[model samples]
Structure formats: C-alpha cells, structure tokens
Target: MLSGRFRLLRREEPERANAAIGLDIEVFDAWTGQARAAGTLSGGEGFCAALALALGLSETVQAHAGARRIDTLLIDEGFGSLDEEALEMAMEVLAGLEAGNRLVGVISHVAELKARIPARLEVTPGLRGSTARFVIA
Candidate 1:
C-alpha cells in the first residue's frame, strides 16, 4: 500500500519506501537503490513521505469494515521545502482526491504553492496579531 501510494504521489521518486513499520520506514535512493532510515530524508523528502502515509492511512480507514468514509483532509505547512517538481507531484495527488469528491485543504505560506492553488485562505501577521484573507481563483 505504501509503495503504491508513494508512487502515486511521487512518481519522480522511482524508489518508494516500505512503511509497514509505522514511523520506522526505510527509504531507498531511486538512482543508487541504497536504502536508509527515513530519518535521513531531507525536509522535502520527509514531507512527501508523510503526505503519502497520510493518504494511505485515509484510504485504509475508508476501506475498513463499518468505517465511515472520510470526505475532508487538511494539511498545514510543509510545502516551503519542496522543489517545484516535487510540489507539482504532491498537488497532482491532492487534485486526484478532490476529483473523487474529497475536500483537500492545504495551509501553506509558500508563494509558489499559493499561486498554484485555485482557492486559499491566507493568514498574515499584522500589528494586532494576524489577519486572514480568503482568495478564490
């Protein structure tokens, strides 16, 4: 499940980690094919792995007997470190979820990500504290 989901979310990553052991996942370099602890992953890599795990878990829950189907998911932060290609991959996965009638809300401050997202709720620090603005398209 983890391997398939990771590939769906990160096609560029060719080699997907085996995450059956919870937080003790082992990641392999796509080119080198060398495996290492998940902790060795860079910020962007970690974020992608975490997102894949969340998505896989969501699917598992929805598929479980007598479990209610989940319709919404909210991810806060973690986009800033991802390079353009990786971010695009993540966005593609989220778009798939949206297409399936699921609501995927991403809370991020990265300008690039913000520009790509069609609708967003932005929060900015202000003199009083913070202010939020909702944007559509």
Candidate 2:
C-alpha cells in the first residue's frame, strides 16, 4: 500500500519493512546513508519512499519487457498516515500513472483517499461475511 508512516514494517525494523507482495522500494532516510528505527519516520516520508520504490520497479520491469503489461496494483488501507504535502505527492504519482493501461487499485479506509483516487471498490462487513461493490467515479 502507498503510505507515509504507516506500519509497513515490524516495530523494531521499520526501514526494512516491506509490503508482503514484494514491490520496488525507495525510502527517504532522515539520516542519510544510515539505518534507524522504523518508528522514527514521519508518515509522509515513509509513504513517499515506498511509493517511489514501487514505481521504480514497475518502470524497470516494463522497460525490460518492452511494454507496459501489469494487470493491476492493489494497495490495502495505508494512506492516512501522510500529511497534506505527502498526500499530494502520493496522489501526483498515482495520477501520472494514468497514461498507462495498468489498473492501479488502492484500498483505503481513509476518507480523503477515497475522495482523491477515483475508480474504487468498497468492501463492507456483514454478520456472515463481507461484500464488495465496485465503483468508477
């Protein structure tokens, strides 16, 4: 998921924390060229880093493959951690991807994200199970 300072990693090693699905990663360290506790990151920084990495990896794969051909990118809830500036930056990145055919899906409970990113699927929990409704707005 694209996040700024959400719990992307374990408490002890935040910098090393990664999405379980394995995407490209780029993190902005407060202390350059060094490692620190994962909890130390401000929300925006962490999310920016992760998003950058993911984007970079996608670019690399497309370059080698000679075409853009990823079916979709699904991100679970994690965007709320960012500040306004960070949120804008993240949105900018998402927006720029529109030129390609890849479908980028971000799953978030944060209302701001729901409003900012168009084309979404909402999941609601019920007594027996959960139901999802797809929306393109």
Candidate 3:
C-alpha cells in the first residue's frame, strides 16, 4: 500500500498436514525492499496493507465481473499506530472511497481524525453509561 508490493501466497502444504492452509499474502517493505509475511507487519503497516488490499480487490471484482461493488467498509481503531504522514495517506485513500459513493466508517480515538472527518458519532464514558453525541463539521 505504502509503495509496497503484495504477493499472494497460495496454499503450499498438504490438506492433511494443515487444514487451515489457505491463501496468505507477503508484503514487501518499501524501505528494505524485501517481502515478508503479512503477519510480521506492525499494527500501522498491517492496517494500511489491509485497507489497500480490500480497496484493490473491490475495484478488480467490480471491473472484471458483473459483481456488485462493495458499498461499505468499517474499520475499527487502528489509526493510533500510524505516524502523521501515514495517517494522512490513509485518510486520503478512505476519502477516495467515499467519493466513489461508498460508505467508509472509521472508528478511532485518534484526535487528528476528529479534525479531518466531518460528520461523526462520538462516545464518551461516564459513571452511569457512555454518552453518545453527533458532531458534524
């Protein structure tokens, strides 16, 4: 996603050896120029990779087949791990999806996101219960 390459890994092991052996992805680190398993990625890197893959796959499926495009995407709380620049890039990607008439819902406690995203439903904890409020910019 971040100038990195995604290599799809097919099932390599025998079915009896590992039933869970399914498709996996190896992500190339832009800095190191080496591919590593997706499981080895940092939280922020993982989030970016996942977002990019989902968006790419959605576009590919809709363009190739007569399949319905994905209408919505919901991502929970992975923004905190990203740096300022990475966060900016991630927001730009999501914004592009929104521009395509797709509903992209992001749930995060990151303060920067509050400034970037306009309409939001925020939840604050209290003694009785969490207070929820709608904030629109």
Candidate 4:
C-alpha cells in the first residue's frame, strides 16, 4: 500500500536502504526522477508520504484489533500544501476511510477543502472572544 501510494505521489517506486545503523529512504521527484533523502521532500510531498504511512498503520491496527477497529481519524492542517491534483488524490484516499464507516475529521482552513467537505466545524475569533459552529451540508 505504501509502495502504491509512493507511486501515486512521486510517479515512481520509493527506494529504501537498510544500513546496519538504521533505515534510509529515498523519494524520487515526479518530474525530474531524481531521488533525494526523504527528509529533503517538500512539505506537500512529505505530507503525502506521511499520510500514506499513517493510513497503512491505521489499517494494520484495525485488522489486528479484532472487533475494535478504530472509528475516527483526525487530520489537522495536513492539506495546506497540496495542489489541486494532489488534493483530489488525498481526498479520494480520505473518502475511502469514511466509506468503511470510519469518521474522518479534517481541520483545514483551505477554501477548496471547505467546498468539498460535507460537514464542518467552523471556528471564528473576534476581539471579544472565539466561537465555534458545526455545520453539515
């Protein structure tokens, strides 16, 4: 699953090296096809990779938890840097989680995300104080 997701984000398979000391990951650029250290990935690319890994871990946990699969996932501001196409891809992946009866909560200020999400909890701050309202579309 991680491999497939890496391909989705990078258009190529991710290469990993297991040194005696630790693990090293190389993520290739989608356009240039040049590999770089995972730590060197841009914010969006790193988010994609981290999201893939997290989703995989969630799946594993659910599978092993028997009758107690995780029911909720909260993503906060992880969509800040994704472009349109990457946003669409990420949304598709997140939608799958909801389809499986999990509650996916995304906390983002991105306008495009607000349009796409069916439900939201909006927070507002004024000189007086702060307020929050939940809306479902």
Model 3: per-residue lDDT, tens digit, 26-123?
66565677767778987888888777777777789888888877799899888999977778889888898899899999999999899999999999
lDDT of each: 0.76, 0.64, 0.79, 0.75
Which ranges in model 3 have alpha carbons more than 4 Å from their true place? Answer: 4-19, 61-65
Give the lDDT of residue 9 in candidate 1: 23
Worst 10 residues of 2 by lDDT: 5-14
Off by over 4 Å in 1: 1-22
Model 3: residue 18 alpha-carbon error in angstroms: 4.2
Write down the worst ten-residue block by lDDT for model 4. 2-11
Determine which window of 10 residues in candidate 3 has minimal summed lDDT: 6-15
Judge candidate 4 against the unseen true structure and give its global Cα lDDT, from 0 to 1. 0.75
Give candidate 2 regions above 4 Å deviation: 1-40, 66-68
User: What TM-scores do the predictions have?
Assistant: 0.77, 0.65, 0.80, 0.75
* Residue 119, candidate 1: C-alpha displacement in angstroms: 1.5
- What shift in Å separates residue 121 of candidate 1 from its native position after superposition? 1.3
Output the lDDT of residue 102, model 2: 63
Identify the candidate with maximal TM-score: 3
Query: In candidate 2, which residue pairs get closer than 3 Å at backbone N, Cα or C atoms, i.e. clash?
Result: 3-47, 4-43, 4-47, 5-43, 14-38, 24-53
